[model samples]
Target: MGTSGDLPDGFGPTIGTLGEDPLVAGVIERYPSAPWLTVGPGDDAAVLDLSGSRAGALIACTDTIVEGQDFRRDWSTARDIGIKVAAQNFADVAAMGGRPHTLLVSLTTPADVPASWAHELADGLAAECSRAGAVVAGGDVSAGTEIVIVGTALGSLATPSAVLRSGARPGDVVAVTPGSGRSAAGWALLRAGLVSSAFEGLLSEHRAPVPPYPAGVEAALAGATAMIDTSDGLVRDALRIATASSAVLGSSVVLDLDPGALAASDDLLRAASALGVDAAAAAEWVLTGGEDHCLLACFPSPAVVPAAFRVIGSVLAGDSGVGVRLGGKPFDGEGGFRHWS
Candidate 1:
């Protein structure tokens, strides 16, 4: 196995016993304390000061990314993986109209993996947390066959109550943050091995997606009826809101997306052409591409929608089951990425 010296700068020396490992020590040093943390890393557990929360409510969500499943080492660096994991976890809190506060990460890696990889991973996690105004309070490490990262995010509701997916009404207007399909388009370009500089923007998005973290709280403050993080895909996450709202409202709700409003961007079209596919294929990426981690929200009216979000669809009363329609027509194509096909 390679030592930390074999890795990049700031990676420090090779790994030793867990208690004496420089990598673990480096991570602890990077994330010492935060305003909300009463007790930071180094102890058996961390303590938080939630008494100052106006709502006295804490929002929590956890997500895991596996080596072969969620990402590929050849496709992304350890730092990129860390940023992605932290982004997705924090996005969940933002989706619920909360302010992200702290994160707990559990990392499992093979013994042969370089200690610097772990150090870079911690740096990445801390970077993303800093972007979200949060900190890595504590976590655990274990040996495994492949790298796996499990992140749990803690947040406080900005509003009196957390916004939920089940709050959308028939008259609600659906909106989303900008740059929805760039990550998916980037993935397509990567899968095709098209490393042209023209698509570098898209490729970067895939490696380290910059989710609109503030939009969630803005939507909540602007009177959003319901919300979700677009980690899965646009249409699929939209359907999630529709279905959840349907059950609560005792009626089938449909999200009628405006095709013109959700049209593919020039970059996606270019990617599609490079891949020798039709424009529809590019449009599909916009519709079904996941990992953008943008927010999809429903507001009571278009006028109430926040400036950060653009109106893309509207909620309608459905006849039988909850569903989605593009331009008032049934979408027959497959939805976004699924765990098990």
Candidate 2:
């Protein structure tokens, strides 16, 4: 059976890897825009220019993180959670081939939680925003039983182009920049009581998913027609892009992965195995699990596949509906994390 791939390090976020998280494809489809708008939610952020020219126009996006649902106070620290909240949102901005410019954060927390958490959160936001070449423009605070973080990002394409998910076509080689699965492994460790520094290092990844923004921009420049992040399992996520772009994606093909990532993954799996958890099954946590915030993308030509990426599959024309195909047939295993099931 065809197995979903671990996203490589460089390509931008894509539905091919992440499946559907935050907002599904239908949501973006609902909000079509005019030319003057420039970019829309379907890409990274929304761009609008009072000026007719697309050059030097402004682009922006808004994303949120909720407690109990998006994150757990027990698992993540105030600072890490804060940074993670901002980092992933900002990654979305980069995914659209937009440069991150500014961020606005809104926080909610229980009365008993430490107030220092907010400051720590701000620090993390500042660090990540600065790293992304963006600034913390503004923010707000409120109260609630669980923690919630809302971030808004502002950016610029400098020229006015939004990298979309439905651009993949037949003959296009599918490749990913980097691999994503560490977070799922780390999360599995935490769930398995292996919360030691030796094992839970992936917790850092889970808290703050490092999406290769530059890689995404590079992909766009390198004829990456379609892009997405691995927020869901590979099969499920790639299918979304295939269905949208009318192409087929397979994970059984040769795909490159970071040695460090592979090593880290092996360790996590070993620990999970000792805990009676399926390390291979745990691999699917990120493969199929949502919230890793990794990027997945499609390249128009094999030349566009960078050294960091591997040719995981190809976009085929014929019928719509993406799936895990191995040996020219549908490969099914772990479906994906279902909501409310």
Candidate 3:
């Protein structure tokens, strides 16, 4: 909030229309130190000292959100954007069965934008960090045509081991968090301008995904063989685990799922019904439609699946590609989301 006199010549005097240094300084003044933070917000690089913890390894993930492409300002406020970005970045750490610790953010926006919007964005980031037991360690800001936010989350494994993508084997049970596809269905509703009070839950899910953070750690503790977050769609992410783990054993993996399982979420079905999307189209959204960030894990056995997860399918010996099966037969339809497609 102060002048940028201490900053270099190129930095602006006001926080609203500033160069990188003053913007960084503004962020520093707003956040305080946490117990685990050794150096925060004001150095060549922010530092977090995790040496005191028993974590044998660190998990890190980074993600970016672009205006118009990833989100619309009309659909999401500054705060919602901040929280959504944080949720996505931290969800990666959780997918690896880690406890999120800190986030480094980078923001770029038009010079004319109000400074208050930036503050709200930061507040949203902080709120999500608090929810995930993490902190805003540091970040940078710059000028751009549209709002762009990039967040990197550093986390520590709850246990010495990580629930990696390369752990599943033949006969492993495929499990997922409850209520998949609501975000995708919600997205459809938003596009159709059918957003009403009846679809509020789905709408919220699309805007701000609340991935089960603890479920990743719980899966790790329950001896989960492999895990992935469904940011890229359920089948696509499942294929990642299958592909990675299958390569280790030199055997192909198949994910056998029931369409009913994907359609099981009440909100998803309700939203689908409201829009008359029908059973087949809803199944496609469940399989595809990225950004849900739900955890999909493979347990050694169905019985070992933790309380937070529901067994939707099983891992089987097959070809390298992920095969979706319904009623013991190959299900026919396109599978999952593609970034460049």
Model 1 — TM-score against the truth? 0.93
RMSD of candidate 1 to the true fold? 2.7
For candidate 3, write residues 7-57 as lDDT tens digits.
543343344556556566665676646887878887778777777863458
Best by TM-score: 1
| Candidate 1 lDDT score relative to the true structure | 0.86
TM-score for each model: 0.93, 0.73, 0.89
In the order shown, the candidates' Cα RMSDs to the true structure are 2.7, 13.6, 5.0
Per-residue lDDT of candidate 2, residues 79-160 (tens digit): 7876787777777776676777667666666655543455456667767766776666555556566677899887766334
RMSD versus native structure for model 2: 13.6
- Per-residue CA lDDT of model 1 for 1-341, tens digit only, reads 36754655534534443333556777788774677688998889999877874345889899999998788878888889999999999999999999888899998887767677777788899999999999998899887788889999999889898899999998899999988888888888888999789899998889888888899999999989999998888989998898899999998988889999999999889999998999988888888888889899999999989899999999999987537899888663366878887
Worst 10 residues of 1 by lDDT: 10-19
Q: Rank the candidates by lDDT, best first.
A: 1, 3, 2
Global lDDT scores for all candidate models: 0.86, 0.61, 0.80
Candidate 2 structure lDDT: 0.61
Candidate 3, RMSD to the unseen true structure: 5.0
Pick the lDDT winner.
1
